[model samples]
Target: MGLWLSCVALSSADVRISVTNGAAACPCLGPAKHTPYTTMRRMTTRSTSGRPRIAVVGTGGTIAGAGNAADGAPSAAYTSAVTGADALIAGVPALARLADVQAEQLLQIDSADFTDAQLLLLARRVVALCVRDDVDGVVITHGTDTMEESAYFLHLTAHSAKPIVLTGAMRPGTALAADGPANLLHAVAVAAHPSSVGRGALVVMNEEVHSARDVAKVHAMRLDAFASPHGPLGLVVEGVPRWYRAVTRPHTTTSEFDIAAIDALPLVGVVTSHGNMRREIYDAWVAAGARAIVHAGFGGGTVPEYLKPVLAELCAAGVPIVRCSRVGAGPVIRNASFDDDAAGSVAADDQNPPRARLLAALALTRSQGVGEMQRIFNRY
Candidate 1:
């Protein structure tokens, strides 16, 4: 688990671990043998006891799932969110060596059932905890289904530089080789690490660290399910976090959005485009009180020729539209395949449909202008 520091060449933008008073320091691997950047940054211990104080906020998922199998065997059929946060921490006793951990049960429900109100509550709770003097960082245990969306929302809304990490498991906690304990431990370790500060909200799964804005769930049942299209920011090996890169996008303290100011998230609906698409579906969303619409377009966010006028009509009626790609990877370039300018629509940039809808909802809470919304999508 030790990094080959002897072969690494240091550089200006490079980061190094500085373990003080025999305390463990967050470590990372350098690019080459002696990486060369003129400036160097060191991560040091914060607490007097040399252990960072970490808060574990739990929103139950498969990590807390329990199975009803005879003879205590793992089974596919199980009940989700059957356990609490304290139990999860107790299951991973090794976390005590990493940080002074505390657990709080925020919610017990499936990620698929997570509502906008619940997301708001969680974000507010996390931001509130981040400002406390006793807490150094926070780790969230969430369901894999909508973890990325929730994490991204926090990334844009959290006002602190303190580390906020989200983690979950692909298998139920009652399974034979449940991943919850290890994932929770790594999440705590990453949250406690000083190097994780200022990185914005992160998702730690399969022992890998990913920026909240980029990571997505690609597989349904595999242990290694979460992945980032822009690639993972770093990795956690044997409870040690090794970072490879940093997020360039505006996030956390740099974000303009604030959790305190947001009273309620506006309704932003998503409509995925497909062959022989129907206009009624799009119309229904708008009629159902959707303030903004995110069209999950096909290939470069292209709109069907027939539905163009319908969308253009809606845009003219004062509703903003966002063109986002339905594909798994790549950016949805503005005015590439679709005439976003003429239709008064904004491109989702690199964000997927659901994420685009989230950003759109958040952006609408502040402004509804096409240009400003487009800029928000671009910058964030």
Candidate 2:
């Protein structure tokens, strides 16, 4: 009888970080899967009047979870947990009096599902919103998965002077202990702070702030999984943000990819490098009609010698090839090892794959030549 009781007690142990609420199991999101976010409904929270009009854009993630109790044990606490955009706002008490917020469901997608079209669409929404006299800033609810990519996309495209901050959750809001609420609330506080302006798009996660271009999902499963490859740009504590570094790339309220100026861009491909390779993929892209290819090369942008000829052929064919390193820790510089005689393509040495792809496509759309695109990438 004693053994039976002990076993039962041991089965119900506190997992995850025990918070004021309760404990969720180790995987926090139990058999986590990629499911679209729930639909947007009229979620009511206390609102403030005479505050700067701020737009709350909901893109989707664990922040909008909907799970049932039957899926777990008896003491599994709440059977079903549901969180809305309004709930994200309410979680942080600091935002209620600071801004008049309006929630808009831009898209209900896991950040992993984000695509080029979605990036453009979100940028367009931001561009339209920032010009309004009543609108002071923009806040986004995103999945930590690919939050950085989307954030960087907005940073390069939106060109806004107002604060544009993206927030995400490592654990679902339904979990006994979730990080979504705090992260969302902090993002709102960051957005509403006048001092937050002019920093370009920012990612506020786990109390650490990062410039979008530098941040990446470094850990697979931790509340504090995200990290900026170049270290944090700043941090947030007690509802206030403090900065220490500057944004190095061209961004925010100043960029060549203006919202109204761009319409259609050429098709650009990013090929990641690894040991022992083939030119088949490059040839395939060229055969299938790729206008340009961003080579995510190995270690400071070095490509296999066997593939160099194919790259040269692509360049000779008038298709641009932009060299960017796959390692992503540093820039990809132009030289002989990465490119033979700098013949066929331009270098994306200083930019990540996403940024490189953006620059390549934009360059192709504008100048329509490899040399011109190279100059544009360098200038930007």
Candidate 3:
């Protein structure tokens, strides 16, 4: 179990420290049951009071879980995907004040269990919703585990200029001080705001609005989990989105990739570097039908001297190799630690391993040459 919280406070007389530990297991674990209210339905977009019609699509995560039997206490013991989209929307009535919100139950599985088929289905559904004449924006409720990957995938594929916001909680909704309601409210607020247009997909969590390309989950168990190395594009202050910066990279309407035309994503493998690594692992991944590989290398995307020949051989054999740093932040500059041109490998810039895999998979659909692949990485 991980340390849940540690807080320090200072007063006139003394200093006080408090500590909390997360639950080892969910006490309320049981078979999942469907509630009658959890069904998907569409509502009229424009009402008597015209508001930006926002669609709230739910794909289960910790935000919709009910782990503890207790009513008002924080506990990590819970089953995920227990709650439904309608219930989540009903819990946050303030969402209606921000926009004409409607709930659509897309899936009720943990995001770690989320499959490539489900991802393609969700992307198609989101694109369908965004193009509708009634809908103005879309908000996705997802698991924090893989939220950044999904956000970046949508950022690359979805061509709509309307806002797409993704948000989730670190704690279950039934827990004390559950973060789902507030995060959802902020997500809807950012989606409805006109300022969010043309910013591509956004991840709204812990009151910060991050562009999908830059945001990554930095902490495993913290309310402020998601962060951008370039700093957040803005913050949500009391239901209003305040802007500070903008995304310069190509995304959404500016991007060349299209979700509707992509029926499947190519298989891309990621391997991390460690002490005394062997070349057989790379061979196994390639044999398993990986079209490309992302090497999550040591600092500065350095490869072990012994393993370099194998990577070079793979690149020469027509499989594209991408060199990316395993570190949390920083770019994998081309030809910095190794001669990328000589090895016929591409650099991942500042993108992390998982993101590099997604981009590599998408890039293969258009072209497979190392030069074009590197250009795609550089431009996107």
Candidate 4:
């Protein structure tokens, strides 16, 4: 009898058990072994000191948006950035089980209206949070339209290895089958995970995790809107994150770009090269004081035959021009057929035009040399 009771205790301890809402009881241990289940319940309801401290910063995107319909039908016409960060956090009760979560509202606007000033402020705030000893990780709720841009911006400037994850939703919070709560919960899980350290900035959406540099909002209205042209880093399954690969490029603490020293970024514009494009558009940008231009060239970053001379003139006048592809995916090889090596022009390598413009602006802040700019593109 003694041997049998000892075996029962050992076997019950070894078996994984989950008791939800005090409804399910362990069959082996009875009332005497209920202490472990009670402990687990306490752990889930409140975070202990051992839990990772995660700060959730909300910038007001579709995830927090609400609709006006009395029936609570999801509507894209609703105002964005309407919900506060605390409410967003409260909406996801599962997140409380993963980390010690706190939230703060940063801004509330449609991402299409996001400006450079707002980007700068957001980066500074992220840097501040990452440096704190009390905070283990940070997550930003953002609009998907420009989420990639903001993520990449933080990837380049944030000087910490602590995880920074960005997430958003296509439908409003009031919509049926809203993805915001799930995305937010997964983002918090990723941010609190130990493996996420040194991964630079990340985008978590629709169960997939992507590096900031490669992730983009490819679809307009689908739940699976974000994807990386290269491939995602990993995915979240059953509230646990699994990473498949690591980012190779220099980022965070390894990056030379620092947000602390930069008060204002230089003006950079993207111009699409098309059939029969005129020179006045190029000249007008220069006249408006654009320090650099990212030419979204056709098919492998080729400048239109007509605009080549104008671009060369702009380069000679100390306005750096970067050649990037409008083809969406693929690298823009340097010294291509249309490249003017003598004019100090540089290629954007694999970066898209919008990202190229951001890099050009940051590179210009450090140096205007063509070689230095090219090196920045290659390294970052």
Error of 4 at 295 (Å): 0.3
Error of 4 at 307 (Å): 1.0
The lDDT of each candidate is 0.83, 0.70, 0.83, 0.81
TM-score of each: 0.89, 0.80, 0.87, 0.87
Give residue 165's lDDT in candidate 1 (0 to 100).
96
lDDT of 3 by residue, 200-257 (tens): 9999999999999999999988999999998999888646566788889999998989
Q: 372, model 1: CA deviation in Å?
A: 1.1
Clashes of 4: 0
lDDT of 1 by residue, 1-380 (tens): 32211111144434444432244433433333343311233233345665678899989888989886566655567888889999999998777777788999999998988989988999999999998988989999999999999999999998988889999998887787888888898898788765677889999999999999898999989888999897898888656677887889999899999999999999888998889888898789888999989999898888888999988988998888899889868998988888989999898888998889889988898887889999999998
Q: How does candidate 2 score on lDDT?
A: 0.70
RMSD, every candidate, angstroms: 4.5, 13.4, 13.3, 8.3
Give a tens-digit lDDT track for model 2, residues 203-321.
99998888887788878668788887778877774455556787866787777777677776677888998888888888888878889888888888887888887888888888778
Per-residue lDDT for 89 in model 3? 94
State which candidate, 1 or 3, has the greater TM-score. Answer: 1
Taking all chains together, the TM-score of candidate 2 against the true structure is 0.80
